[model samples]
Target: MSTTLSKSYYHATSSVSLSAVTTRDLLDSVAKKTPEKEAYIFPVEKVRLTFEELQRQVCTLGTGLLSIGLKRGDTLGIISSCAPEYIMVQLAAAYIGVVLARFHVGLPNSLLKSALLKSECVALVVGANNDDVYNQLELILPDLKTSHAETLQTDEKSKLQRIITNVEASQGRWKSIYDIMNLCKKDSENGKQRLEETSKMVEFGDPYTIFYTSGSTGPLKGTLHSHMAIQNIYMMCADRYEWTNDDILLSACSSLSHATSEMSHIAPLILGMTSVILSPGAKIHDNVSVIQNEHCTVLFSTYPGLYNLLHHGKINEYDCSSLRYVMTSASTIPTDVIQKVSSIFQAKVLHTYGSSEALFVSGRDITADEKEIIDKVGRPFGHTEVKIVNEYGKIVPINTQGELLIRSNFLFRYYIHDEDKTKQVMSVDGWYTSGDLAKIDRNGYIKIAGRSQDVIMKGGKTMYYASLVESLLSHPNVKAAYIVPVPDEELQEDFCACVSLIGDTSISSDDLKDFYKANIGIPAYIPKYVMVFDDFPEMLTGKMDQKMLTLEVFTRLGLNKEWLVHGRKA
Candidate 1:
């Protein structure tokens, strides 16, 4: 472990004393009460699992994990499609007190290697069905390199010694899905007995999950979150959203890769609701079908995925009367898009804003007049204390744009093994610097301006990517937009609009330019250019990689030779 600690204002306000129960405890609690009640329903496969059955499988595989010498505080890398057994592994890790770090399988080989290395994962668990992933890992095994490889691996002999568990097992190391389920059935007979012994040993505040933050600057960083932190976040968000035991939930976004799915899954599961797991490779068409067929009442998706759904024209065909709460985060949700979705689905469309370091800081009830709260990220998620602070750590007045800082019981434990990186965001006192700039109105509603890195300055006024992109997304013909700054001889930097048009909806550059000039309302003095791409390059977690886009533009525009700011002069 790293010895350095960075000062965060959040540390002074509170301690990491949140109470959390192990996954086994949670499953056992639900099993004892819900018993035969259905907890998960895989609508596509027509498969279902009762609480008792789910708990039964968890304990046995937990034994499978332990049988391979897997111990508490060890990390397991899980890369697979959404499966009952995959979920079982996560539960089993929580049950036995091992931390589960789920890797995004869709990431490029290089990025995936970065995550695996950064997490120092002892054993990697990939699904039997995903043979491609298995092959990819094997293909790159010997060549896998990272900064921490040597420090993370050694053949020391001690009871406290750490080594790879999943990959090094003499037997059952790469157990198949069928193998685990078969063993789970055999262990069901002793489930009750095993549960009793493990229940007494598990402790709250122990690390249960290590979620990697979607890095925009470099490789992703693993953020360690405790079981207690998970529970607190789940309870807070569930209460604020009025999530009930009966609500059917679905996530079109990468729930398996994000903290939203990480924490939000707890509520419906703990409350005895049936969770519908959308299949991998699920496009916009599949999403509509899943909601209609599964009778899904709540859907949590990112802005891009939702936008894709709207543009595909499949949303209106589905009988989506079952939906009640439709929440979006990760990126800004357009007001016009929000209003259209609400009108079509007749459900509440909520726009939420936060990060992996801090989940659900604020949300707006964007059920009506999407424009009203579209610019605003919304009010803080129930009881969360938010402040706009300047560089000196002093609070800025309302409506003044500054760094958005948050103080909540739900901050992450630490940036996993990266103290220097942890200090960059968290203060020793107890506040988390979001790296986002925002302002609050007298009504307590918060409106985001842009990310600190994404803000562009022209003349003396600053133009936020969020506001600029929001304007482009408002156009009926535009599907998605990215405002990437490019090099300029006059103003040091100019704005370039890279857009993805609606599917089958064609409009020329001149048409777009005319529309922007008439509708966007930007200053004429600022240099503006438009480039249309089939699709923007996206990070593994599905967020736009503006840095990559900038690099590509620099090369294409012949500006890389002398441009500052890598691609744009600043």
Candidate 2:
């Protein structure tokens, strides 16, 4: 094992050795080791599966795919919410050696079609909750309603009718998940034979899943991860968090499309832990009940998720003592929120830093000091190396902000079918520039300043929006804060602070300006305008959509199109 510690960089090779294993093999191993252990629980749907049951379902689904003519290495698109079918399809796709491409259920029709076409998906699995999927299918495949084809039946007769109607219109173009399952039952023996042969053919380095980044800034790009990378990263995390078969993990995050949901789906399968998947739109109290009843050991969520739970004002009514760790990421979490979450759940708040391109880079331990827990995103994982470099590609000293570059065995293979775009972010030597401005302290803790694009240039000096937002978040009335740059004829660009306050508490624009001047003490850093709202527009991943917020600010201020720095028109 090799470990390096220096002011300019930090590197550590994992002390825990990992052997080559496919996701299918990993699940089979766990099922053999602990067949009776509960593997998945969906409280809202009233569904439960043991490790053996999960493996059986995955095999059945894999055979069903083979029976329906889905070849190995073919891309399968899953457009669904977090449900048992989603998990089953994900695991089954891996078993059949197909690349499972996740399609955000909330994506627009245009982008959704683009992703499907780009990934060359041969089949799609959709959910039945909302009519959005049917509506999108109408626009994408107009002939779907007119064709005659086999369709799946659901308990809801009306929903099943609508799905059949659409599937008929597709003219045998796509197969419904239910239809495929029925086909699997007809060819169980053949599917089992084929599943065994195909499982042996799958290599550890083959792509397992493709996740598209949340396109808050621009168009979404598809990222591919090998089976080895995904399995090892989650194994490392399971070790880091000391998870075991006895632990029950609960996730209130968004759909399985995002990386956050990977913890709920992938980690449990590898470690033989039980994962509770609450349906989308579940009430905060319902989540609390899952913890209290299921005795969940870990609650994984975004910062806003935990904040809303705490804001519900009934945490005291629920027994959350079983929770040992509250894991959060995807945005900057205020110090006050961290303290309140720890107090409410009686669990340590652990923060993690990762992106779709890079799987799991760094995280803070639950036993970290309060200051480190609140301020830094902790040290890099044992298998990862991190360094901060200036624009000149030179390493920066400790405590100095620069672009963060990471080298890890868990990084994605590349952006699918976009070598030019992939080359822009990743270097030949395996360093993936994160496009995040950050700093490392002498103690090796990493502090993310902000995204490089989020920097506001004022009077020839750099100002970080995250720093300003963090400063304002310290105020008692502020619930969330964001800063964006607006065009200025004289200064080139000016800063605008968008704030959402606590319930029934109002802070005036003048008062905010005064507060900033008193606290920050930087005249140029003070916001030229303060915009308050009941809530900020959020992306699917639960992070504030700064791009949308900026446009809202421009329209509210009645700024001219020419005055906008990015030339965004009204």
Candidate 3:
């Protein structure tokens, strides 16, 4: 029943004075001590914001929000590309205990509107150049896109298309970014006074954000978190990962995902480190340049993006020797991908597993051995307890694969209003069932197999789709992979892999099958069919839509009759 961190290596070696401060207090303290130290690096434009300056801007925006009668615990809808302004607004909302109902600008405007309306956002702040956002809103009510040229990217083909599609000239309700900033800046002198008012009675347990599940499975639901959750991440990273204020962290990936929400956004900001924020519409090439030019010490990216960087030979050319850590999350990384990326960048890559409902559970610790790195996600950090359980919630034996249930120092309030779904998955006894299946070794390192629903049973042997997908993704030519279990008259169920390869790479399906069989140690089960794709259909958060991929496979190969033998078709 205890939530306190056990007296382990973390408790024995460290001074625990950091426990007293919350995330909001951490930001305020950093602003005071290192006001002029660079707080953020803009990788696209090479712009950097000092800690003090960032706080000042946050305060100004906070005052502007307060003047408009926003209150604590009120949700503020934010949809914009990554910018210093975005960071400013995020911090301002945190300072006032405003729960951030964050939405990525890339999200379909229809989905964005639904989420906003559901969160009941009292106020909204957006980038000046978001014509797409305004146009989408204009279909319902009057709004304007911000006309700031600097915030808008001119050359990107996809970005331009979005802009054109969303902006309607006839609608007059849109507001300009210039006008909003001007008003906030004019009232900058009173920003601190506003921050004081917001923080006067705020506490560590107060809710600060409500991030949505990436919606890979179903409709997106908001997961509520308190400042205590943010502080828990900061403490765990500092206590275990050797993070410090001197580290220069670059989050080229958007901060909306569950992994980046904790790692890139909260970890660096609360630790008083220099964070490099990517400009909206920034590319991977721009990230390489930032690493070299900005002397980025730490890097964070998704599994596919990490592979894409290495496969394109971008990592070899960049002078990123200053880099010490590279982390990937939301999915597992292949051993081959890690070995190549490590050799090229000369930095250790860490893999972590968690959910939007709970921040972090198990991570591949840097200090752990190669076997721990490859075979398992490392031991739990700080006050987190990981348990492997059966269908009845009974604890499973070590080295036995079961659903991963996490009991952490922090947990989300609820999944918005979906109380039924919340209670079904999140146990009242402090455990949140991850829906992911993993086996805990005797040493306590956990190896992820696949999601419980994603596991396929054939002839009484369970085949993990993710384990197969991880193997295929390790191939040099495979840029990304998806595995689908289709019904087979011979085997009951069999897996077929769909892969998106690197451009102009002429690797054949036979070659791929041989590669996986040789490397992964399973020849007969190495995917009966391997289909290649040029690009993947992704949800707004950049994670591949497996459901859509499966549907495509169903249509192309007509596998629906094969797989839907017992269960109804979705």
Candidate 4:
């Protein structure tokens, strides 16, 4: 690895070169260069496809899409897990310049309705499972008994024209993906000719797909990433992380719909690395077995994923010596989880920090005593620039806390169809305000304090939940802690600290407060109310469900009435 350690703003430079290329170009190069090389290893499905086969499969699907009136730049949304069908649609959409959009597998009816109208996806593809990915979606589609193609009608007027799915429904309106694949066999010459012509229309700047935010706080917003932007991320990561053909990456804690999995699915094939993907909702034991059986060398996971794996997973009984780096991101990783993963897996714990706006902005591989400073997200990646700006829109000194801003070639182009939201975060000169409070120390290590929204803005004083949560995490009996804002008639907002204990250990709210008073040391870092939770709910991305947890706290405390500034009843 390159020695990126430095002072002065933590901007790491790279000697590697970059280019503007579409995803199709990279796949073509790899397929021609190493046709027989393994591109994917889906151990759960007992499926392995070579580079040449992957190329053919994507191309076939690309032409098939065009045969059904789908044109370049038409949005095709996918609702699936880490299945082969999802990969085919993802790459095929990129091959023909059709914009891809994704929805969570567990999307609710209300959110699905809201997203369908605004997402502008002309077609939607679902997984083989009729109940999981397509349950809520099927409610809006024509009934299963509908016989004619004219019966295809959505509840509202939408761009939706076709509903392609892996499952073959009895109705003709629902187009089967297998039928789309068979289009190549019927008109092989015409399909291939049109595929070539359509491929030429693709450009580096065209929108590749839209990724929805976790929506833990509110409704999901569609973020658009360009073909060139994703390619930049792939090239930069291959160079920065020093990934080789020998590296085997194992996907954990996320589905293909997540941003973290977007490039992981395509870039590994282009970079000549073997990617092993397990099914979504796979148990911890099965995940550990895949690493042992596949001889996996690397893993990308979130905090809860690591914790669940180490705590509940039978690591000592299995052979996990092949692990090289346990890369983590998506949320603040607890130091305990990092130490356990590093110690058990004998791997370097690499901390990463990014958002929907930009992915892979900064990461640090923990070694030696660096585990003690696990809060730092290392330095900025190459070809990326980061700055801290105050509320007045002025740049701040190093080690000062302010909103984080970043400029990179790999950032998402803009929020799709929401120009006001785009202008709110992205500046005219290209610096995207992250809305995250952070700092760069003298040694050039970046530390995330908290999100700007995490602060309690009331009583003319801003109190950050990060400090109090950090204190709560420092408690030996605490496992996870979250400070959620509660409505107040006078202060406008008061907070309640909800904590989950380690294992079966228990502590009263009074005892927890006493421990914080004696050991916390920082008087400003205190909580107004405290409640205990058996465990916090987690989103699909393996991050804590802050929105749902906040609601639970409110419901438990009876938030309808005026609550005091201190000592809230639980």
Candidate 5:
């Protein structure tokens, strides 16, 4: 089919049927259908939970939460790694209709406090192994140092209880998961009744979970999603990938805090597939060993994680023939890396496009021709509608880059406690402005250019750093490339290319600049300053930290605010 240019709007041709079932109900149904099936495996912790065992733990913990005065609409904050306890708390929170607020383990104390306070979480769950959590909790709750501070009283009398897992000690007001379970076991009859009633009350439209953005560029915002929206989005993902009950999925990119965790961990439980949760701080060899030992068939991680696995020299020592697909996203995938993944794993590489607001948007399978895999992000998701619009909000022609707008049933409900931020991105008509510059091809595939904020202006032309970086990555010696804007006298902004080369490649900055000028064929697009780095700063979510890199570049180059205001000569 030829591409059509009708306001640059395109809707997905395929759609999957969805059910009006809550996440709790879905899990129960799966447990009932396959009671003996393996649901979760934590190799690092040596923990395994079958479908029936998982449901039992969820029900017990959910009852314990309700016993501690947590009710529907109350929020439970989880700051932990990818462990069995984390999954238990998450499922229990969802089962009891409590809003699960996931806090990344890497978040600073200031952001962590802001997230918990803003979300008004009634309870906090932390893993004992996470030293940051212990350190931050002392600052957040000063009373903890005095004695066992069971609860923090708010104006509304919504007391916040602290629960810590994997430790036998319940010092200071912190309660252990074992203690909570014991409390529920002591009143098993009452807990069971309360759990059953609470589960029955939950509906598909109820708020399920809140995930905060990485906040690498701005303040963290908690994005909320309803049970129906998240569940169906994952269902669609499973359908798109044709995931089967026998498939074992491994998540190496993030823990429970990230959106990808839900796709790799939670969704697989409902589908009766095995989910292997790797512990944090796992190395490249650990990942490969998990896949080999677990006989994992599906792998979901960020581009860096996949890239590491592809180059981990010892990967060939493992029996990875069971792997069927390696799904990665969150940043640009180098063309060579994509090819290497396929060649090494003999599996399809899916380059997906998604965000905290919109769960799963579009994905391209790298098993296709090299050019198509490198150039496009696949078609619109089964139930998503995407469009490209210019500054005037008018539809742009096909293949013309503009800000992307998406309308999807799976879009987040709103930013918790931030109506102004919610209104900034969401329109009354249901369209969510992505703030990403992208273009749609005639054949309906979408290609992301770069964030609108990242566009560098040179002279009178707009230059997208992503395109330039992609070209630089195509060079054999270049391992990774990042483009940042620098103040210029003649041009509005000059380009600064920060690159890391393959081990001891002997490729210099001048050599890369010459290669770019020869290949890109744009004199202005060639970056004026080329900086070489052994490594780039990365955010918790595994994406390169562009904001930090830019700041560092300015500081190192002795560029000041005066230079930005009145060109570099100032």
Candidate 6:
């Protein structure tokens, strides 16, 4: 045998194949075939766009961005809800390989400033859908109110040079998004050349999006994902879920700032599935009518919203039988809830397990027998490698609780601009350390046994226990505070600020509200409900008995029935 390996040996080394495609490539290919097919439907705005229309919008915006000097690899931040304009900016930026840093329209000053600085965005795009964007941005960029339409020159330290807006405000403050779109069209000479050059420079390996999530024991982490990463996940998910071009997908909950946005927005856009986007300010009840009217094939989020809708029999008023399946990964659903939801919709309940690190890990399809899906997160995808490892980094045996390690090409490239955080979570060999506690059985099904991180999934947003607790403890009137998850009918979970005040400081609920109004405006932290505790319960091991304390809190809040029906703190 020769020292060098043969062609067969080289091929056998790896079973996975890389996808050589970008979001732009997929959209272009789909639009070419389905030129007149409906690609997006914005019910609230009464807007419907075909494949060609949407493609033209994306290209126009991409060219306008190029005209404004935001080229390939430049960071472009967006602050808006999941409106039609927001989608346009997202796709347009991706079209020319501009990295997008999606900011939640509801984000407070504290979080937004940090994210903006860390992302180092060259330009920020503001959407007209939400009014909060103005108030929030004005706090960070003091010059936002005074800067002319040309470029932003602020006292804040970052790469920010321009502020673009789709909304009408004071004239010289920002550049109109509409004006920018028409800027290149206004100059046809340079526009064509820049568009061709920019499109050609776009590569499959370019970083497409930065999805920020709450850190386990630290600050917010922005997960950088490549075009290849996003494309692979969409391709794999569509194949696995048996999605077809005829499927009409709607993101019933959350927005593009979420990790699931890739599947909801980009997947449907590129894969020929009709994307039904709701305008900003749509209430929880809007989904019911949308599903009834559009005959949406799939509902893309949630736990409590659907549960409450069905539990109260409100869904009976609508003909939503067109739904083929409801996909959710916001949090684990109890077995009883899964069965109830499936029956209510007459569709399969697909419970997924995913995170910012590893886009899609595993999922459970509700079966007739409870044993099949009970406490199980199903098997890993074909491209994924999973193992339950102990504290010592050794692989544990089947059915043993340990940290779940995920290895896949679909995993995020890294934590954006943070090498230390990236190295902390990922191993040199490419294993991602997921803090979740899980177990693998002989049948190859994985069961989640809780997790190490004190994370609360409120509605569809991720809130860290440490961040809120620290904010609470920092108050002059507070001594100790513990943030606990409370169940609700609307929001999947709510936060209860259980606090033990410092001596002689008599701060009532109103005082807490006032404090939150001044210091913490994030709804996830300063919730509507607050509870004052004498002290938190402790275990024999001298540590806080979080489980017992949570139960006590629930009982006191008169929410005992919430946990009994769910069976456990999932």
Give the per-residue lDDT of model 6 (tens digit) for 211-327.
887433346788899988888877767765778899998876555676776677776655788988765456667787899999998887656456545544368789998998888
- List model 2 lDDT by residue over 210-290, tens digit each: 999888656889999999888888877887777887899999886678876888888777778889988776787887888
Q: What are the candidates' C-alpha RMSDs?
A: 6.4, 4.6, 6.3, 3.4, 2.7, 12.3
Model 4 off-target regions past 4 Å? 1-12, 141-147, 168-173, 365-373, 457-461, 487-494, 561-570
TM-score of candidate 1 against the unseen true structure: 0.86
> What C-alpha lDDT values do all the predictions have?
0.68, 0.79, 0.69, 0.77, 0.79, 0.74
Q: Where's the lowest-lDDT run of ten residues in candidate 3? A: 157-166
| Ranking of all candidate structures by their lDDT, best first | 5, 2, 4, 6, 3, 1
With a 3 Å backbone cut-off (N, CA, C), the pairs that clash in candidate 6 are: none
As a whole number from 0 to 100, the lDDT of residue 472 in candidate 1 is 73
Best-matching candidate per TM-score: 5
Q: For residues 1-570, what per-residue lDDT tens digits would candidate 4 score against the true structure?
A: 333333224455677766778878888988998889888888778999889999998998998999988899899988877477888898899999999998877777777767777778788887776445555666665443353562245556677867787554433456677788787889999999999999888998999988888876455778899988777776766665677888888877566677877656866655878888777757888767888898888887767778778778888888889988888775476777788788889988878788777977887734424743577887677788887778898777777888888988888888877899889888899988887888876655688888887787545467777766778898888888898877656766667889988778978998988887788775556666789888787775556788778778878878753342353432
Q: What would the per-residue lDDT of candidate 5 be over residues 467-536, giving only the tens digit for each residue?
A: 8787667677888889878987778678788999877778777888788878876688788888889889
Clashing pairs in 3: 35-52, 128-146, 143-173, 143-174, 144-174, 487-562
Higher-lDDT candidate of 4 and 6:
4
Candidate order, TM-score descending? 5, 2, 4, 1, 3, 6
* Residue 469 displacement in candidate 4 (angstroms): 1.2
Clash number for model 2? 5
Q: After superposition, how far is residue 428 of candidate 1 from its true place, in Å?
A: 0.9
